[model samples]
Target: MSDQPVHIIANFTVQDAAKYREYEKGFFPILKKHGGEFITFDDSSVTFEGTAPPQGRVVIFKFPTEDAATSWYNDPDYQSLSEHRRAGTTLNFLTMVHSLPPRN
Candidate 1:
């Protein structure tokens, strides 16, 4: 397996839990298209370090390739579904590599 890692961090608000479910449903196909993995994650981000009450959900995913992730995001199908994610929540995101220490 490649040592490179694609880490995705998303902090966005969902108008309602039901809406979130809908968004998640629509989100699955796109993610699957890129052969991404649904790693362990949580939504109970009640507070932030030295910040006010958080107002959104937290999501993390590992993509095998940056191109794959980008393609999945820019895909015409996902382009529109992405709007729902934005509409339902305040999106805060960060995408980067792990850059772990060189394996001995």
Candidate 2:
């Protein structure tokens, strides 16, 4: 694993809670399989200054390394389960960001 962690940020609106729930139930196992860890999730986020703040649910997660994060995203099981999310929600954005290096 690299010293730098990778973070996944997702913003979405659930259209079908039941189907989305199914996706949620299956997400964690695949994430852990590839060294990913859940960070936090917020259904309501207050934006202090941004012109465009994320609407609906915002989720954040981290992985030991970028490779681990990417692998988890592309894993076959995850892809299969993602269908439920796709079918049940409007995904605004899903992005990966690398952690900043430590400052001297």
Candidate 3:
């Protein structure tokens, strides 16, 4: 994979608030363990042009490298934690975007 930074865009709608909250509470520590950084999240994000906007929540975060991003996702603890998210939310997508290479 490219060494470029990778950004994650996750969109979901909460179905069970308490279960989703459980996921959120444990997310940060695992993210940081793999060099991830939370950028921002929006409950009401505007989409000027798109096939369609996501459901309820739009989240953005980044990792220093694609490997880091993948590692975070593949981590067993993260996978376990995501069970609560799966039970709590209707996930639209969790997408990865690569940053442009440094200008020569």
Find the candidate with the highest lDDT and give its number: 3
Rank by lDDT, highest first.
3, 2, 1
Q: Give per-residue lDDT, candidate 3, residue 47.
A: 76
The best-first sequence of candidates by TM-score reads: 3, 2, 1
Error of 2 at 68 (Å): 0.3
Q: Write the per-residue lDDT of candidate 3 for residues 1-104, one digit (tens) a residue.
A: 99999999999999999999999999999999999999999998887786766659999999999999999999999999999999999999999999999999
For model 1, where is the 10-residue window of minimal lDDT?
93-102
Q: Write down the TM-score of every candidate.
A: 0.74, 0.92, 0.97
TM-score of model 1 vs. true structure: 0.74
lDDT of 2 at 59: 96
Residues 1-104, model 1: lDDT tens digits:
34465766776666766655767888877888887776655667655457744655677787776777777778998887776666667666645555464679
How many residue pairs clash (N, CA or C atoms closer than 3 angstroms) in each of the candidate models, in the order given? 2, 0, 0
Report the C-alpha lDDT of model 2 over 1-104, residue by residue, as the tens digit: 55799899999999999999999999999999999999999999888885765478999999988889989989999999999999999999999998987799
Q: Which ten residues in a row have the lowest lDDT in candidate 2?
A: 46-55
Clashing pairs in model 3, backbone N/Cα/C closer than 3 A: none
